[model samples]
Target: MKSLTSLQHLSDQAILSILEQADGTEFPDFANRMAANVFLEPSTRTRCSFEMAEMNLGMRSLSIDEAGSSLQKGETLYDTVKTLEAIGVSAVIIRSKEKAFYNELQDVHIPIINAGDGSGDHPTQSLLDLLTIKQEFGSFRSLQIVISGDIRHSRIASANASVLKRLGAEVWFSGPQEWMPDGITPISADEGCRQADVWMSLRTQLERHDAMEPVFPNYLEQFGLTPERAERFKPHTILMHPGPVNRGVELHTSLVEAPFSRIFKQMANGVKVRQAVLAEVLKTKEEKRYEKAV
Candidate 1:
């Protein structure tokens, strides 16, 4: 069984296979199999989308959160996963506050899908984003994509930027200087707007920040996709955000549902992308079992 822990480990062929599966109409049957969602951190999109994907694939699923789980009693994450596996879970999806949380579960038998891990990576989100971009532009090569906003605090930024660059897209970072990560020189918001073929915004992670003060007092005017800035974008430029969006901060409220916005499309694609991932992992396990039986 293969666990999808990071996009870095997902090969080009595997990515193509997942995207192709997502585009197909037939659903694979895993009717008797069970999956578990262990979210140590709060989530809305990733969690619900995985649950929907599991349901659509005919898999029984259990949802566990920190408040209701044994972790509150000081049980470690590794133990929780092993317990789930012992209980006959076919796979486990985890979203934890710890970076690279999957490192501890190397011995677990079942597949572990990383929903999100601290500010480290969000592979599924990157997949859905790729699906969205591919559907729009037909390819990733030479695409000028700008990922703007809370860079340091965003798992999406690191995940998407790395994959996009590897796929031959010219990825640029844009946001407040303090939020930018090392080795990435961010362009001004206007420069990003003028050049980007795909402009992606990231929500300011207030929950991750220690200071309550705004990172930039005039964030919307200086770095956001305001109506005026939107006009500067090329006619074909499309907008994207890994939600939940800070309406007036990361992007102007008017731009959320604007004609070029692919924000909702990204959410819809999340289910399909996850369905493809789940199917691949489970089917691989089945294939190996069949081989052993033979």
Candidate 2:
């Protein structure tokens, strides 16, 4: 309850409760308390969604500038978190390139939400994805979701795989062999498209790789959700991406606007998912305070 670094920290009941709350119109008050968003990495969706979530939940938000803050002057993350605590924030949502970047802040009492950490996880994104899938299929049990494209360095793949499996979804991977991770089934993009109930594509993480030339010059033909491969999908098969989509690289540009594509819906649901998360964590903090008072 104090921190949300992984989905494993939550039970099925807990996850369901949050999702239900996300669907409601009622907003919880946090008196005048605030939350800090400290993003050391570039973000658009995650950052904006969380800020909107804060606004909808009746909580003020503080945006930390890593450049302007003492981090540029070599301040440790622990000290920065402690400073936010000193400023009386109720929670801290952080995104950094270092995996488990907040692990060292054992003494910091505020709730810490991990926005993302290297190729580690994007739990909130996965939760919204679950919400989107649940809306479409009613449940995750026995559903087939084929995730295609860059699997080796995608945090979305790592986060979604664990949660989807926990909810009884069969996850398959389709991409170049070099992009395949250990234990993932190496299905071809076309075959995966034909068999999937959902087709999720990923952006190539060029930033994560060291100096290298393009391994596959024709990535669209080799691994992308090209129009031909997309045509092979069943009528009910949905398309999804945790985007900043490389239009033709991961999926065809036209497919992004396809009727089955839930990419924009995913962005919309992100605010609700984050609102529920912030409310739940802040509510726990409130209860703890009341308990000590009694």
Candidate 3:
């Protein structure tokens, strides 16, 4: 069975195929199939999007969280997933605090969709982001995209940057100096806002930090998409944020629903992207099963 643990596992053709599938009106039926969402970490967007995708495809969804799962009783992630697989769940979508948590589940046969793994990679999020960008720009080549915010703690930053760059987009990182990673063109937030085709903001990720300072006092003025900074943006520049947005922090409250913002559009596209992913992955499993039966 195929699993989508990273974007590295997906070819350009495969990526385009999924996006194409998402835009189609008809979908395959998996009425009797079951999918499980096993989120060890807190989430709203990814989890809910997957659940909605599952329902849209006529699949039953089983939700498992830290509080309600065997994980609370010292069960390992592998054991928990194996249990679901043993029970014949069609696929398992997981979000974990541990980076590359899927490494531990290599032996499990079901299709594993990495919802988010610590700050490592979030393939599905990257796909939805691509869908959002593609819907707006209709292409990725030579597009100036600036990913600005808490880069160190952002899976969205890490996931999208590499893929965007490989797809021929000129990608840059702009945020707090402390959060900036090496090996990318780091620009000032002002420069990004002024020139970017897509200005994508990341959340502060306070829960991942050691300190409880939820909002840095000068984050908005310095690195965030404030109304004043946004005014400097090109007329065609589109704003993006991987939600749950911290109003007045990574983005000012006024810009959340501004004419140029694609924050909600990203969330809306997420369901279709995930629906494409689930359908494609599970279709392979069904094909193999048919082959074996024949």
Best by lDDT: 1
- Give the whole-model CA lDDT for all candidates, comma-separated: 0.91, 0.88, 0.89
Clashing pairs in 3: none
Candidate 1 per-residue lDDT over residues 170-235, each given as its tens digit: 999998888888777899999999999999999998878887545678899988889999999999
Q: Write the per-residue lDDT of candidate 2 for residues 1-294, one digit (tens) a residue.
A: 767888878998877777778877587676587999999999999999999989877789899868878999999999999999998999999999988786788899889999999998888998899999988988899999998877888899878988899889999998887777876667988789989999999999888866762477799888889888889989999999998988878888999989989999999999999988898788888889899899
In model 1, state the lDDT of residue 47. Answer: 94
lDDT of 1: 0.91
lDDT of 1 at 23: 73
Better of 1 and 2 by lDDT: 1
Instruction: Estimate candidate 3's alpha-carbon lDDT, on a 0 to 1 scale.
Output: 0.89
lDDT, residue 237, candidate 2: 92
Instruction: In candidate 2, list every pair of residues with a backbone clash.
Output: none
Cα lDDT tens digits, model 3, 1-294, are 288999987888888778888877478898989999998898899999999999999999999999998788999999999999999999999999999999999899889999999989999999999998998989899999999989988999988988898888988889877776765556898888888999999998777887643456898887888888999999999999988998988889999999999999999999999999998889898888899899
Candidate 1 positional error at 137, Å: 0.7
Full ranking by lDDT: 1, 3, 2
